[model samples]
Target: MEKVIILTGASRGIGRAAALMLAKENIVVMASRDINALIELKKEIGASGGKSEALPCDVAKENEVKKMIEDTIQKFGRIDVLINNAGFGIFKRADKFSLEEVENLFRVNLFGVFLCVKYTAPYMIEKKNGQIINISSVAGLNGFKGGSAYSATKFALNGYSESLREDLKEFGIAVSLVCPGGVNTGFGGAVADGKISRDFLLEPEDVARTIKYLVDESETANAKMIELKPRRRKEFR
Candidate 1:
């Protein structure tokens, strides 16, 4: 049977790659704040003879999150997987970050994941079958200079995913976290500045393939957490 999947942050980077890959075999509902990008992706998926739907959503806002979930349910009848890939990063010294900036980051990165799960879990629980994949970072496992604020959110996400896994296990919903290191994306607005080299970073397709693995794995086997990093370390720093 084809699974109905809701993928947040579908506009770019890992989310975009995952949407394209998943849509080839399953129904993908692409959610992101960039409606135009989602539309373009939708068209691309259609061109390839894949199923997809584009939705404009800001995961940090509860109303928008609720509406997106509700709308997906209305359209699909059931959601077989929820990929919480909507996130961004703001790198700076801990003291350099403004309170509002920290708050906004947490809202989108941490609280937003919670909101999506909160609204979507009930359906999964009722069905006793679903998958939730949270896209995290290696920053969650290790700290770095100028990454205090961003690291903190990912660390919190790590802890959250751990507990969520335990909570949902009994309900038969699998919660998995994917922590990738140094992806060659425009994340944190760093790629354009030439601060990092694309040669050493993991491609978004790499992470997308990992996501496909988790989705295709047998129901009895739950990959609690998967960490992915580029084989060649980023030397530029």
Candidate 2:
């Protein structure tokens, strides 16, 4: 059976790559705040003979998250996979971060994941089988100079995903976390201006492939968490 997958932040970066790859075999329901980009992605997927549906969703908002889940369930009858890849980073000194900045980061990076899972888990429980992949970062595992606010959210996400895995294990739902080191994308206010050396960064498709692997794994086994990093490390300023 073709799996029905819900991928957040499908407009760009890792989410976009995952959507494109997953749509080749599964029915991908793509959600992002950028409706224009989502529409364009939908068209591209269609042109490639892939199945996809694009929906405008700001995962930070509960109502929007709820509606996205409801819409997917109504259309597909069941969600086989939920990929929470919607997140951003504000890299700056810890003291430089304003309260609003911290709050906004948490809203999307941490709270947003919570809202999505809260609304989607019951359905998976009812079905007794599903997969939830939360996209995290290496900063979540180890702190950095300018990653205070950003790392906090991912750290929280790490803890949340661990507990969620335990909670859903009994019901046959697999909760996995993918933590990738600096990827070659426009994440964290970084511009993809082609100046940065690609050797030091992991490609979005690399993470996408890992996601596909997790999705294709046998039901009786769960990989739990997978961390990806570039082999070469170079300083890019």
Q: How many residue pairs clash in each candidate?
A: 0, 0
- Residues 1-237, model 2: lDDT tens digits: 699999999999999999999999999999989999999999999999999999989999999999999999999999989999999988777899899999999999999999999999999999999999999988789887677898899999999999999999999999999999879888864324444455678889999999999989899989988988776765422
- List the candidate 2 regions with Cα displacement exceeding 4 Å: 190-199, 234-237
C-alpha RMSD for every candidate = 1.5, 2.1
- List the lowest-lDDT window of 10 residues for candidate 2: 189-198
Report lDDT (Cα) of residue 129, candidate 1: 89
Cα lDDT tens digits, model 1, 1-237, are 699999999999999999999999999999999999999999999999999999889999999999999999999999999999999988767888899999998999999999999999999999998999999888888888777888899999999999999999898899999999888777874454665566778899999999999999788878988989888785323
Model 1, global lDDT:
0.90
Whole-model lDDT per candidate: 0.90, 0.90
Residue 73, candidate 1: alpha-carbon lDDT: 98
